[model samples]
Target: MDDDDDYWNTSETKAKAFNFDDDVLSTQEILAIGQKSYSPSGPSEESLFNNISITTVQSAAIPLSSLVSSKVLDLILLAQSGKDPSKETKYEPEQTVAMTLKRLTLGRSCSLHVHRSMKSKTELLDGALAIGDGNAVLTVVLFLIQTLNKKLVYELLSSRPVALNHYIAFLQNEGKISELADLLTMLGRSPEAAMYQYQHTVKTQGNNVDVLLRKLTNLLANHFNQPGVDQHQAKMISDYIKLLEWQKHVNKPDLKYNSVIQWLAYNCTHHWHEGAGNAMSPLTLCQRHQITPLQYDWVVLNVHAKSGKWDIVESLFTKKDWFGRTTISSNIPIETLLSRLSQLQASKQLLATCVNKVANSDDRLRLAHMYKIHAVVIETLAKQKDRSALTNYKMTLNPQSEEYILAENTLRDNSIKWKN
Candidate 1:
């Protein structure tokens, strides 16, 4: 026995000689090991029930409940306007569905009476919004502000922004930024919903990107004389004579001539302002829209084309709107501009025009413009020119350019990768 004890002690000493820190176990693992010491088979049911308590669930956990009553389940299905008897939910299934299943199980009260006499919260909210019932609207909005889901509390907001805004303002009034992210994320994913929400948010918050761009332009202009050379140059180039021309054309009384005239004047940033002379001013609308620069450029171009800036279509291709279809530009007018641009090669204003108007829709005319652009680019490059109009135009107009073709190929490959 003495020899056995010495042998065990020697083995224990050798084990202790190793770095325990290197083989340290987590508290959970240590607790598991400790638990094995008593019963060894592992934790008994008694200990598990004694030591653990559930606090919360991100999702719900409904339990099997005969008390929920089949009749009540039928009523819920009917309430949802579901006619299919096969789709009927069972008492146990509600156990996992989020909500007060426990309360539902207490079928002691006449739930049908309660369910029928009182409209589910959603109907009440929708009805109130329909009648412009402020009290109901306020209550629903406050609840929405507090929680993303109004499944039980109120009806989900309808797809209309005006209608939705009617609710959003109510939420904002109740200070509901806390629970807005999930809802906003949903809205952002939905094109129409996002636009609606955007307009609503702008109306209520008044801190939208449209206001920011105006501030940026004004700030850049005011601080043009500052010490930083780059900042000053940005303002100078930005405020160049063409900026005014573009703005004048953009703001002209003839709404038909302007490139982008939204119902809201405050929203259209000077994205394609090719003002007097060849000097032009370009501003990005993507920063405000929360889209990629390339994606943003695509949206801006479409908006421009839709609006009327038939001349300012090239902004889609200037190393920004990457992968955008050059053929799409042919849909806009490139022929008329091509002749004017042919003579006007050596101006920054014209250069901006070239960049902004690179999207030519007419294939034959666009091809002609491409040829003219190519000619102008060769001349400018030979003379060591610094961004002539034709040079800028050539940079974007020629879809056949090696760089343009490469970018198009890469973009196409990426699209395939993502879709697959």
Candidate 2:
């Protein structure tokens, strides 16, 4: 009977649970025991809990409550104590984690268990501010996926709209971009339904947003290539691509100063993806939003020029035209006025017309600068002074006008280069 009692005591099931609260464990010892259970070479999250080493002399992770009960996990408890645990508004880590684990292990058999934990978690997250609980809220947002905690997902979106932007940024950093696409689209439709449906699918689908983007982009490109997809569908695909790109820059707090312009330039042109062709011009969207035509023109001008689209390049000069008895003048340079003035000859008359129609000292001064660029172009193209055109230009320049001085200053500069 003595031996039987001893054997019973020695059995693994009867052993006391691991207690990590005894001392500040050495890093090496913690790592050693950690390797035994968590597998040193194993995948992530198997690492020591938190920024602390609690692997040595442990049970199954100290049942979160005991950690809180022992004051070792007070941060978790403190965060919870800020709000009630039973309310459907706070986030209780211990109960939440336990409920998640139960749902994961038992599947549908314990779905109710996960829902209950989600309610507990909601209470914990309720009163917290955006930046304070941002990380924790995002962590739960993601973890609830594997936990299959839909209750928490709904609670988060419905009550914690404050953290939605940060939540997007978190998902972006984690490289789960497909989450956004799925969140924005569904056969079911509606933003709320799409939101929850996509959140629920995370654990099942896994992370491969990059791959999904490539494939989806490719699919859309091919679909649009078909004869009947229609321009509207093509525009939808383009907007989605732009939205995806914008999400990449979500950390930027402002949008009015062309933050998106640079990103769009680099993303769409740096790589030669056939799918890239499917992206519609951002200028089109900007126009729809009631932005001035000039702003759209400016963006296209820089982007196309930088990307080396010669046919689209237009030289700048003043332009004027007659309307009945009235004359209206434009500040736009000659090349810009003619629209597709890529051909050298086409630009010449365009330039002449602009020079003849100038109505002011400022316009004439601008014309002198225009003439200077013309002279250089002619010299390069003809290998001799196009004396007639040069003489005509000289005749048009007003020496004391802003045009002559402005043209002279620019002409004296050493860096001007003309390219087709």
Candidate 3:
């Protein structure tokens, strides 16, 4: 018996001395232990029940019935509570729509949800608007506009001045110029509306120049002939007409003339003097309109060249620079000018003077080929003396032609001279 007791004491001491640090508890083991130790009557259970009761009491403190008559709101709350909202709330479509709009006007952030809810209740919204429910009308109208319900928005804004004004402001903010113009006209501001429509049409539909002209003429003759219209506005219209007429004459049917007309209109509006004479020359018009050198050349080609105004065409090339400064002695390459003159079949003296002004070999060759000038061709061929250039020039003409034979002989003579 005493040996047994001593052995048992030794075993107890060894068990007490075993290292616990090496045997860490895993998460599942710890959880199992926690579950085993848990009791329903514990302090944690009491605190949980107290918290739940407190939350229930707080929720019951607010009378939701008096605040929102919407079954949809009730359903939304039920959904947030993880319950079936549709089963708990009564189905009242009209009341739900009215409540949704009210909530929207009261600055709720659930507009998308409200819109979804009100999708099928448009008649309720319209009825509310008809009965002069200002709040509901504004909310629904803004919603329709936001959702791009153009048909409804137009219907609502048709006869309602206040609503129309709001829609017009919205269209203006969105840069819907055509819609804004139509609304403005409906509101009896026809002259202002016409101006906007005209500007818009000119910008977007400028290819329809005849239509634009007709519209402008009708506006001037019919709409803007009132006493209250500003004279400057009238002047603007008249200047636009003149500018359009000028562009119509200058550009072909296939050409884009809007930009040119816009430039003219800009200058006519800003730079033109009221009493400026109608006798203004093309150069004066160019100067006033601030035409670039490239644009000036285009005008000369299209207008002066086609009109048999050779002197005017020459003056365009000979006169001022782009900024209206005198460029007669500015050493411009007259190759292009000479080419144009050659096309017009100018006199030999004139061509010689122009060719002398630049004195480019290439220009002389081009002139010789362009006009079939024997003297210029012989001079250029002798100067260059390139066998290949002479051959190519001969090939471009008839094989047995006099010009070809002369060019070949010129090349042979130059080769003999070089050999000497």
Give me the candidate number with maximum TM-score. Answer: 3
Evaluate model 3: give its lDDT.
0.58
Give the Cα lDDT of each candidate: 0.41, 0.45, 0.58
lDDT per residue for candidate 3 within 1-420, as digits (tens), equals: 698677757967655443457554333333333343343454553454664765444433345455444643434445445554334556555436556655655667544344453344455455555666565566566666666556555665675665565556666667698777765665557778767766765776666778888878887886566676667788777767776776675554644455553444333443444344332344456654456666656544545455566665456455555876433332234666666667777666556555545467886677666666654666576776556666666777677677667866777773444322
Q: Across residues 1-420, which tens digit of lDDT does each residue of candidate 2 receive?
A: 697787666758354334467564333434444344435465445454556565554535445453234432432343334533234254555435445443434432322234445455554344234335454555545555556544446445655565555665665566665565343333222343333323433333324445444644675555444554456655655555555554433433343224345544543344223342233335433433343456545554455556666344343222233544222244345446444333223445445554445545355445535555444333332223234433455456677676455445544445544231
Which digits, one per residue and each the tens of the lDDT, describe model 1 over residues 123-233?
444555665545445554554445444543323554534456665565456655434434543554233323333334434534333453454455445433344335535
* Greater-lDDT candidate between 1 and 2: 2
User: What is the Cα-based lDDT of residue 418 in candidate 3?
Assistant: 36
Error of 1 at 231 (Å): 32
Work out the TM-score per prediction: 0.21, 0.29, 0.32
Query: Of 2 and 3, which scores higher on TM-score?
Result: 3
